[model samples]
Target chain A: MHASLVVSGLRKVYEGSGRRVEAVRDLTFTVDAGELVCLVGPSGCGKTTLLKCMGGLLTPTSGEVLVGGRRVSGPPPGMAFVFQEYGRSLFPWMRVGANVELPLKQKDLSKARRRELVADALESVGLADAAGAYPWQLSGGMQQRVAIARALAYEPEVLLMDEPFAAVDAQTRADLEDLVRRLWRQRGITILFVTHDIDEAVYLGERVLILSASPTVVQEQLKVDLPQERDQLRTRVAPRFAELRTHVYEQIQAAKRGEPS
Target chain B: MTDIPPEPTRPSAWGSLPLRVLFVFALPALLIAFWWLTSDGSTNVYWPPLRTILRTFPDVWTRARLRADLVPSLLRLLAGYASAAVVGVALGTVIGSYRKVRAVCEPVLEFLRAVPPPVLVPVIMLFAGIGDTMKIVVIASGCVWPILLNTVEGVRAVDSVMSETARSYGITGPARMRAVVLPSASPQIFAGLRQALSIGIILMVISEMFAASNGLGFTIVQFQRGFAIPDMWTGILVLGLLGFLLSVVFQLVERRVLGWYHGLRDSSRRSS
Candidate 1:
């Protein structure tokens, strides 16, 4: 059975120096097995806080996140996270291949098997020749590709990406979007992508979960009725793509206006 | 827009290697030449000619007692510095990683760190006697602070996102420390080591000067007291050369160990 994610009433309150800031309040969502779900929200909407809660990086003030029916108290074994700051997330000291192989070292895999996995992941990301190079030597897009390779090499059941393409240029962002879609289809790995870009959410996910401003809740979860085989140019210009984009865009605006959905 | 500037030409072959070396050694060579020329015929009691000091170098250095003193001094320095390095890194890692440990030890460590090693030589001699043990203890106490404090700072400065990344990947315990934390903190740690090496050398001489019967410092002092002015000059010259050689060796080792950090920094600098 494919691993699914269930974040139930996940509320996160940051208490510091007698001041309580409720980041995510009573938020509930589920991403089905093998599904590509995009979480789109306004800035300061606690989308990152919610993702951290789901990944078990941050403990929720109340509620819990479950992966494959097991509550996540710590980082779940089947999950891998791709952080927004690719520069900081990937180890600068390690070569691209070593960076990809690092998480696998924790697994009980043979050295040869780990090497093979790193090679395959790098190849899949089109960074096969860049394996020996350090992350700092690569361009921003290439570095992010290495980050993706690291996540892919882990062979995770659920991949959590926190605005993975935000730092790259438009063209590179489109390329990465296709890369994510291809990987999801090829591996059937469930993905929960968090982004602020409405168009990106529509272009990438099967369903887009819209989040409201602070004391955040799921404002709406819209199903994207686009074709499975999505292309950057063709899929984006499609009538259905525009409709889905506009729908998500308007919902985010209304949510930002503090309207209760 | 202004016209583009022409590209700068590379230096000539002579300028690249031969001239570069000449330029680097020019001041020292000139100073030595000046000293030799000025002291050629001097008959002053205290300021003996450079020739006499040069003549006495072989006499003092080639003696059987030279090995006896020099070897012991080097061994003590090595032992004390090695012990300090191991203990300092271990304790520093513990202090840097956990908040509780750091909070408890901060005040005590600071107080101890403020006291110089030379100052402790007499105090240490009282407890341990005027022996190798006392000398080593004094050297270690003096050298440990730089390494310990640097390690603590390095470990504390590790990027939060990087640590989070490590945690999320299930890289915990010693594996995390070895792979992520140590490497991240390495540049700072190396900076500490470099600082400690110089301090260790200074302490080595100071500790021996205070109590030990034989060492470079003791030998120099002995020559001075016995009115062997040329021998005293030779001793000072040998100590200077030793310090220079030690620093050169340390720099080579540092370059090898911190090659990755340099490469990363250089590439980033070029890109920016």
Candidate 2:
């Protein structure tokens, strides 16, 4: 497994209102290429701040983010981010095809290739017919799909998603999670997914890294030994699935109590 | 005008049809009714009846000579509006992006915005001379503030999340403005444009009134001097009609251009 990203001792401090707030501290992690890892934590646990640092959307005070072995000073060109607010993530004025096409345009791809990629990305999200439709015209699920298509069309080496399915309905969230898994497997792109949903993390991540709330620290990284193929019904009912979920749940409980692991 | 509505047609017609029908007919009908009632006698010489105005309208509308005057006034209005849009948007973007620029310019712009357009007419007339250039300068100066102020508002109000998302994609500079910033700010910018257009029309009519050999304003004054009441009424009615039609046309274009934007539920819709 090749490391697609390396975060070493990352920290971010924001100053305002006559005070200082440390959002993240002493964070270190590495994601291998084509490896899907989910960061699970309580709300306001600096999960977003950590993602921003990793993606180069925010600067860290005294640390570095390495993408494909190069230190990321600003948003690294090879990584794409899918934000939670589908309402805001996609540009409302551009057509769905154009929204997906925008990031690709930044790449050195030819116009024909760009067009082909945009078309394929939209199709993969089950939004093939929505190419000409604007972002506002689609339902929430469809809008999120457009956002995904935008990230996918960039053909980023690593896709960092921050609660990408939180805003959508539960049914849509399940479908989207499956979609992410399929895309990760098919493209072999590294993924760093941040979510507060324990089931979602366990269901989607090859490895789930749980963190403690407020001044977050990594509590544990649990390897999911479930079979490669997953199902909503059959797989969820298995004994190993329950055991894995219980173990992750206990870790979270321990985190909440500030208990020694 | 009869075939199209200026406002968007939303799904579910529940009372929307009648509301739109009222929007279509109310203002013009009310204006006409006022003209008809007032024309009964010269209760106030400034006001004239709809019939008298309608009868006198053709004399002004049909005259081949009046077109020259109308054309010059229109040219001045368009030049001023175009210049304002270009400069206002350019300056607005800069001022909006940079805090220091905004702090320096905001006070000066506010003072300019407050100093009514009529005061500038005389000053511009002196500097630019009694030509179309003077009128254009005055009109452009008069019209620019609203567009600039509104552009600033739109740009300042840009959703930060969108900007961050754009940055994450390595989108910056002009590409970011074109793709992310401009579209996000457009609804507000167009609002400014709409207001500027209204001001432009007012300045168009006013500049002609201040001093012009032709144009609708000049025609009104010239007729009043000759005691052509009907002709005077005709010119005023024409001004009213032009203002109404211009607003409708603008709204139509705004809706078409901002189709994606207007549908966005005013954004705080998450609560609903």
Q: Highest lDDT, which number?
A: 1
Full-model lDDT, candidate 1: 0.88
lDDT of residue A258 for candidate 1? 94
Best by TM-score: 1
Local accuracy of candidate 1 as per-residue lDDT tens digits, B148-193? 9999999999998899889899999999999998899888888878
DockQ of 1: 0.42
- In the range A1-261, model 1's lDDT, one tens digit per residue, is 444999888889999999999998888888899999999988999987887888888999999899988999998888999999999999988988889999999999999999999999998989888877778778888889889999999998789999999999998888899999999999988999999898999999999999998989999999999989989889989998998898888888899899987
Off-target runs (Cα >4 Å) in candidate 2 are B1-9, B12-23, B30-34, B41-50, B266-272
What overall lDDT goes with each candidate model? 0.88, 0.82
Candidate No. with top DockQ: 2
Worst 10 residues of 2 chain A by lDDT: A132-141
Per-model TM against the reference: 0.95, 0.92
Q: Name the 10 consecutive residues with the lowest summed lDDT in model 1 chain A.
A: A1-10
Stretches off by above 4 angstroms in model 1 are A1-3, B1-15, B63-66
Residue-pair clashes per candidate: 0, 0
